[model samples]
Target: MISEQFDLSNRLGRGDRTALGIWFWELDRVLLALILSLLAIGLLAVAAASPATARRLSSADVSLPELYFFYRQFAWAVIAFVTMLVISMFPKNMVRRMALIGFAAMVVAMLFTIILGSEINGAKRWINLGFMSFQASEFLKPFYAVAIAWVVSWKLKDKSLPVYPIIFAITGFLAMILMLQPDLGQTILLSGICFAVIMVSGVKFWKLAALFGMGIGGLVTAYFTYSVAATRIDAFLFGTDGITHDKLALSTLSAGGLFGVGPGLGERKYSLPEAHTDYIFSVIGEEFGLLACAAIIIIYFAIIIRVALRLFEEKDYFTILAVTGLVTQFCGQAMINIAVNLGMFPSKGMTLPFISYGGSSLWSISITSGLILALTRRNPFMHKQGQNRRYNR
Candidate 1:
């Protein structure tokens, strides 16, 4: 059986008749493993966080199970896994077309969200869809990245494509929509990803400088205009006793020391707002220990480094830009979420990818990961031929 497995893995030729066979030979299995590991860790972290969350929300009139959130997250994980696999199997052109359609559709959904979405925590970012609420911005992110990459890469082929202005217009339009939803976190994320994509497309220094200036100005405007943004910033800056989440998160990590309090033994999660979502890293620390937290960080870094290194050799301009945009957004969000947990950055309401407990977030990231895997796959036969020559057996 082991030999058969090896044969299937090592022999990438005309005899391989299965889709899974091709995928097994071509896919970045290490990256996939790392992603699955993070998801597994998320399940454990959410399981630890769920009991308290359930109890806190439960009332005499509305009793709930302790594992309520855990169960729901598990279901979402299953769905997300299937979604990622299916998407990763799609051809490159299909992925491109999918992104174009998804971007347009999500834009419409986001606009409708502004009109009819449910307000949650002062942001109209989610549309209530009977069974589950959807955050359109989450879905928009990867699609937007791909679409921008498509347009910018065209400019690479034909110099007169006016790519920079088109990039700016699309980004500006998205930023306007995000600010209307008052989703500053997603706004900043979307802008940063767009800038990175444009930068890689070899934009002029002045153009990059202008965008950076605009980003800074946007920050200042957000600080003054958005009460939530202002409150978070002020709390981070001047309010000694007001950095409640940060303080608690740091304290929680300290409590775990090296190993942890063990599984569901995390008491600090009870006091942590959005423990299973935004602050899930802190829960991992308190329950699973600093070692577990370090492992998660290592996995994230490995994935990012692996993708960035892979892109170094890629020759296609669109593949380079799109994958770079996707991976940058992936790592950037991870950094923001983890930084917020560690009190390094002001709270951004960003969920840790594959871990944070949001259905839309989980599914959206799955789509992003799927696209990355699809774009990054090498020709299996090419890879095999190279391997054979290197061995010289």
Candidate 2:
């Protein structure tokens, strides 16, 4: 089996018609290209933001390179791209199995994180793994979506199954733990994923209405309960705080106006906190211009639309739910990050999907892209009738 796999890979590399080659041809190349485009833009944005971040972080004891974050992000991007490519080659069954297993493992990891995680900025969200710190929630997001989709897809097998309740319970538990970590951003993202999945699963309109109501109520509760959320919300709504991160972000974002000041020429980014991670969108605005920011948003919309179009005729329940959930998670996060950067939403320490600097986030997003590619792969020559026959089974 190993030798056969190796031979197939060799044939794929040589552009010969083989199993691997078939996989490549069946892959959603347009979606892949869009993802890669974002990755490339992310690299440039990181490079532009790196100098300010490095300088701010530098001290008398240690001097860091100007492109410190950029170099590290570049390395992670290479690894992430390779990981995505390999995972995208997996068969559908393997993709589902991996998500199930990964979801289970990440749940355990999240528990460990709550118990023994390193505290950063008053949030215990990272587990130190010697070489690097691991954020369980980041890795858990994609897997959670796939797992939920897998569970909810069971309705087609038996309409009487309590799949919705099961999904809600799982999501609720996850949300509770996330709130314990005080990660309101991720909690909100996951809730959105669950809501999107349920909505696509044919739940009643009134039920979705109730769910949305609950979500809003939850936010209200968080405002009163979570100090971080309250502070940020107050800052956003009332402008109670002077020179907050959001204010700086908006100022930095518009500093370049339409065409930007050119890469690394913006001076405002130096004052913007989390410039390479959460506020990278603003950094891109400062250096790459508002036009680049608009283009990035368009690319995100294109990716979401591309996936929706691909799933138009999909008959498999799991495929529809899983794909919907993943894309919702992807674009939803991007929208929040962009909104926060524009001072339209409260500051959430959420990284801009593929355009932010973080090891775990980069890898998680790569996995998301890979799963999307894997689930959406189809033979171009297959007739609609043949495709339906295959999916209906």
Candidate 3:
């Protein structure tokens, strides 16, 4: 019946088609729609934002080739969609194993970047391969969630391996690479994901508290190892007087106001160095207005809350960790972008996920979201009926 409601193009939700149903609370339609919506918006945002990039690079006088960025983005969107659908259709066990393999591969790739990678904007974060370049951090997302979730779930099952040490090892290894890239923003985000997974998995509050303390200590040690990192952190918090990137982002956002200045009318975007990538949200706010920005935020929060709500009902430990970690990373990245936009935080060369432009960011985000989609799909009526049966007594 619910399948009928959503107009099932193919049989889903009963048995073989079970994974396709949107109404299933476990398969939460809203979340599915949200991910799809983001994918669609990524394409649209790329189309909208690319002309500005064209003008900036080629000057208004010269008729350059059709915007290069959007065409690449459109291609990536298709790949991302295929990736998401394929991941979603997978069985739970396969998803876990894929996570393991994927996570390990990304870790290696991330380290490899540090030693034999190209420098972009003063940081050696991307592993460039002549014709193409990819960021290991983006792929690190889903696989990291999968691997940690497995550890957490396994610990719940056997109660042997301690969570913190496992977390510390991963954290330290990746933190080193990120530091080499001089990406403190990513380092902080990774730490947050690990902390979130541990806490939500019911690790004792005392242990959680201790982990945070050690995390802070490790970061201090890191700062000493890398002066560039220490300076970025310091600059973010207490920079000398100047029209900083973060401040400029705020001005771009404020200039958009509640009703936006209309598309192609963003003057700030032309001057903003990372307009098409890192600070793309500012461009969205500038051209589409504050209301559009708020709408985007609301949609993101809704999907996150939807996933969290589902996790609360299922007793599976891995699912709990996987879902929570995914949401945390998703929201954490978005929050960082927002904070930087609002002047509450310093710039952190991060994209606004689906909304921001860039082949790497878009591809990585799309694939990661696919993992979340797989995690949340379920039979809705079955869950609802069970709830009714239990409460109606």
Cα lDDT listed for each candidate: 0.88, 0.93, 0.78
* Per-residue alpha-carbon lDDT of candidate 1 for residues 27-123, written as tens digits (9 for 90 to 100): 7877888889888888888898888788888899998898998999999999999998888888889999999999999999999999999999788
Q: Give me the displacement of residue 31 in model 2, in angstroms.
A: 0.5
Candidate 1 residue pairs in clash (backbone atoms < 3 Å):
none
lDDT of model number 1: 0.88
> How well does each candidate superpose onto the true structure, as a TM-score?
0.93, 0.94, 0.89
Off by over 4 Å in 1: 1-14, 240-243, 384-393
Off by more than 4 A, model 3: 1-26, 59-66, 218-225, 241-243
Ranking by TM-score: 2, 1, 3
- Give the lDDT ranking, best first: 2, 1, 3
Which digits, one per residue and each the tens of the lDDT, describe model 3 over residues 1-393? 887766655545343434344424345567878877876766666666787777677866776554677888778778877877777766678889888998999988888888887898788888877656888888897788778878877776677777657867877788777887778888888888999988987878898889899888877886687666666567767875543787787788779799889877778877777777777778888988888888888888988778877777787778878878888888899889877877787677888878777767877776678778777776666788989999998
TM-score of 3: 0.89
Clashing pairs in 3: 12-17, 13-17, 13-18, 24-380, 25-380, 26-378, 27-377, 27-378, 260-289
- Cα TM-score of candidate 2: 0.94
lDDT of 1 at 339: 90
For model 2, residues 204-292, the per-residue Cα lDDT tens digits are 99999999999999999999999988988887889886438988899999999999999889899999888999999999998889999
